[model samples]
Each structure stands twice: as C-alpha cells, then as structure tokens.
Target: MAKYLMLKHYRGAPAAVNNVMMDQWTQDEISAHIQYMNDFADRLKEAGEFVDAQALAPEGTWVQYGGEGRPPVTDGPFAETKDLIAGWMVIDVDSYDRALELAGELSAAPGAGGRPIHEWLELRPFMGEAHTITE
Candidate 1:
C-alpha cells in the first residue's frame, strides 16, 4: 500500500459550497462536524487504511533555521499569509484512485445547516513509491 497525505486548509482553498464559516456555525453544527470526521476516521481504521490524523490551531509561529550558535528565528503567524493548514490525515491505501475516493468523501463532511461542506482536500503521495513523482 502507498501512503498519502490528505490536507485540509483553513484558507487558500476555494470557498466551500456551504460557505458559512465554522465560527458562524451553531454549537450543535460544530459537534456534528466533529462527529462526522471521527466517524470517517473510524471507518478508515476498520478498513486498515488509517495511519494518523490531527487538527491544528490557527495560532502558529514560523521558525527558521538560524546560523550556528543562534536560536531559530521566529516570525508572526502572519495574518496576511495566503494559506493555513487546518488539519491533515495520513492514509495507507492500495492505489492513488483509492486515495482520491477517500479524499472526496472526506470533503463532504457536514458543515453549517448540516450540509456537506464540499471542501477541497489536497492529496499528496509520499516519496519512495513507484507511483510517486520521485520515481
């Protein structure tokens, strides 16, 4: 099986069909959205396709390598940044087609009004595989 990364972005992606932002969603909507994600993960686990997943906070600090003997330089979580990753899921699947199918399903996670978000998910295959670009 090949490993793939499924990236969910907070910004930079096209607006979802259910464009209402999470902050504007009701508490129950938020809970349902979380439940949908958890259920999806559970399904993947049962299928032996799940590797890992995580959600990220919006607050972040950009750290860069500093010259020897110096601490890493840090920068703002700049509000002007074009994109911010909201979360990611790693999956081991039999084929790229399978990965795409899974991502499409995940993009349909419920959002405002208990409707599908229709969010775009970025999928990237890991290196060292024959099907990967590095090959």
Candidate 2:
C-alpha cells in the first residue's frame, strides 16, 4: 500500500466564527455540527482507511540557520499568506484514485449550518525506498 497525505486548507475559519460570530448559532446547532464531524471520523475509522489525523496550531515561523558566524534569521507566518493549512490526514491506500476519493469525502466534512465545508485539500503521495517488488 502507498501512503498519501490529505492536507486541509482554510482561508480563515476561526475568524469566520468567533465567540461573538458563532453567537448567531443556537446550542443545538453547534451540537449538531459537532455530531456530524464525529460521525464522519467514525465512518473513516470503520472503513479501516484512517491511519492518522491531526489539527494544527495557527502560529508558526520560518527559521534559517546562519552560515559561519552570522546570526540565524527568523521570519514569520506571513499575514499575506492566503493558503493556510488547517490540518492533515495520512492514510495508506491501494491507489491514487482511492486516495483522491478519500480526500473528496474529507473535504465534505460538516462546517457551520451542517453544510459541507468543501475546503481545498492537497493530496500528495509519499515516496520511499521500495522494500519489495512483484511481477
């Protein structure tokens, strides 16, 4: 089986629904949204295709090692960056097509209003030394 990475992307979800912003939703609505996400993850687990998943913290920076006696340089999570990754899921699948299908399903995860986020996901195949070959 080949390993694939399912990357999650969101423009600015947290800002979209802050405490004040999400105040527009009732408690029942929030509960339903949470339930939908739990259901979706459960479905993946039952399918045996869920290898691992994780959500990332938003703060980060880029650091560069200094050459010779120069001081190391550090940059930041640029505010102009539009393609912010929210999370990722790693899965082992038989083919690229299957990986793509899984990514599609993940992108349909429920967001506000029980509607699909339809967020953009980057699907990448992992490459490593081959251990075996078959004819």
For each candidate, give its TM-score against the true structure.
0.90, 0.72
Give the TM-score comparing model 1 with the true structure, all chains together. 0.90
Error of 2 at 33 (Å): 3.8
In candidate 1, list every pair of residues with a backbone clash. none
Query: How do the residues 59-121 of candidate 2 rate in per-residue lDDT, one tens digit apiece?
Result: 778789989899999998798877678788888887889999988877675555666656667
- In candidate 1 the C-alpha lDDT for residue 82 amounts to 93
Give the number of the best model, judged by lDDT.
1
Candidate 2: RMSD to truth: 4.6
Considering only N, C-alpha and C atoms within 3 Å, which residue pairs clash in candidate 2?
Answer: none
Overlapping backbone residue pairs in candidate 2 total 0
